[model samples]
Target: MSGFSSWSRRRRRAVIGGGVAIAVITGIGTYVASNDDLRPLKVDFVLGGGDDPTEYGKQLKIQGQFGGLAVAPDNTTYLFVEANDETVMWRRKPSGAIKRIQVAGMNASRATQAAVAPDGSIYLAAEDLWRVSPAGEATRVIERRGCGKANPLVATSISDFCGATVTGVTVDKAGTVYVGDQLIQTPPYGSYVHRLDGKSIELVAGRPAKDGESVRPSNPAVRKGYDPPAGTKAKDVVVPDVTRSGALAATKDGVYWNTGPGIVRINRDGTLSPFVARRSPGKISDPSGPFDTVGRALDAPVRSGTGGEPGDGLAAIPSRDEIYYSDEGTSHRPVLEGDFRWQGVESDAQKKLLDESKTGSLVHRVTDGKLAPVIAGVQAIATSKDSLYVAVTTDIKYRNTPENSATAVLRVQLPEKN
Candidate 1:
């Protein structure tokens, strides 16, 4: 689940004390008051937390770290768990029966993300792409063809090759699969968006760059701003500055991904645009606004020493254009001036601050262009008809114990849309 290179860079500098100021400002009273609307959405623990992974009759216990999670239309839950040095898929049915799914011929441990199609088929992405049918049969749909020494600059198409790293995957209502690929190799070092329809794969946005070429344009033109002339080839009309961090979603309109600039949308016609604007570090402009306004704001220069908040898990609504995403807030970093160092009290404060930042992991809903925070401390999210399923870390400080190890899946009822 952690294949995004940008995420790895952010995790290195993540200090527990990063959210101390926010905690002090909000306090307990203000925090409670602000989240009053979320109180009615009851959070019921569905699974996890025990000494070991076991299934006894209708009850199941899951331990160790987990990756992606998805909920089928029938309310069946699928979870990827890493235990005993192997990755396995666990399926929990509506009747409370739990069983492990054997995804033959593939290393489930390397799966970075998962999505369930409307027909109840599960899609997994990693170095390759796979589909597990509702009847429990798994097939490798896309074979990972290494880039090798091939030159992306002269190559006309990437239909046969998979990206060096697959960070996110999602299935639309029509059963079409969309994949976000981050190619970190030398010749084609950039991000790409690909669509897999049946047996054909097409590059929708971004392109493999030449050596020393920039993939992210400082001022990327969006939609009509940079429309190709008559008869322009799809591969030649590249949309720059597009990137992803393990988050990708699709609606009837198009595909959405979290990038350094914010959430970007690639329309069905291959036109690129901005969905949400990044205002500052850990902040974003209101999602409900004119597209030109958001696009213009995104074209502005990014602030120094800060990459915009990149979303984590993403899930699209079944029959609606709405989407849900998780934001992992920035980690705290300390600046050293001269020889000044932290004292015992300061060290204790840092520890306390780190603990307080756990609440900063937030889930948000994007509906009718409005972005609303739904819950806190969520690591990943998946959606069903009337509920949102989330994987939440029970104890961020320690995961060595049964009570604290691994994340617990919780189901939260969704509020009626306006």
Candidate 2:
């Protein structure tokens, strides 16, 4: 089950062009408005769309599917692209010069995620954890070690180890590296978040389940389409599909990550708590102020039913204590197949759900315990001091076409705080 679970997760990541379709609302620039207070933001095309890699920086056209995005302190942008089965990191300086950096000794076909440290070091998370120095030197910081064959139902103890599957990576303002491990093959069969300082690795949040232990559901209700065998107790049934984690973002307080329904934080004090509550189905509204405590933030009825399942993308502005998250929405069937086209729908209800999922997929800004919609159809997002960068697919219906499947980055200016 563990091996099959790992393959299922990777297959989901391999699908391209799942972002919500971007619509141009105005002539000056592409402006998307969410609500009245959340003003319409103009999106400028940064770069993307080309047939060849050599033509990348020349005509502002880069070929390949977008993987991840990050911005350094000096406003330099790092865009990860999966081209020819290899992960390529493109660095865009303040002067707009684009340079491609590929880490040596890494597998070309792995789904690589990247995060930039304060000192400009790039951390890549694939099967293992690696650090690419500012000068383009790559070093394997953590090697992949499997837990071998251990039954998750009766394993007495699970070791704290970096396993074969790593879902996401991020660095905080203090230059600490945090990795999200799915721990699919490891005993206990759940997600774990690990923190790596200079010398040691610590399991900050989550752990392998002990013998005969059942992991609690993060959200209130069981997800749709999950059914257990007859007479199986809820506490005894383990579902590997919903027990995954991804997309880590760090702030001064701690690190925030996607745990299925919503985001949770591992605080500076070494405590785990909910940062954003699991969204309920209804109209969402903007709250006025930050919650007094983490518990209040978790329980407060700020709004719900806006963002999709947390973890599509997460970005943080440590200076402002603000975080941005993206949701690709939920679907009844697989959004993309081998050819990048939408899969066949089973029913009208499923088609309606798919159509509704497109609109529910959005990027939101979380500040002072309040969540507000920023834009629609964001695949990945990054932040600079003054702007927000988003990767999106221009046309959704025509994603099967190579030209229409190109991913583009857009820049949105941050509004002045009142």
> Each model's TM-score, in the order given?
0.67, 0.66
Q: State how far residue 7 of model 1 sits from its true place (Å).
A: 24
Cα error, residue 241 of model 2, in Å, equals 6.4
lDDT of 2 by residue, 130-180 (tens): 777766676777666755664322322233354546667888767878877
Model 1 local distance difference test score: 0.50
* Residue pairs in clash, model 1: 16-354, 288-369
State the weakest 10-residue window (summed lDDT) of model 2.
287-296
Instruction: Give a tens-digit lDDT track for model 1, residues 299-386.
Output: 3222212342222567776554566665554322211111111111123322232232223244455666655544444456776644
RMSD of each: 10.3, 11.7
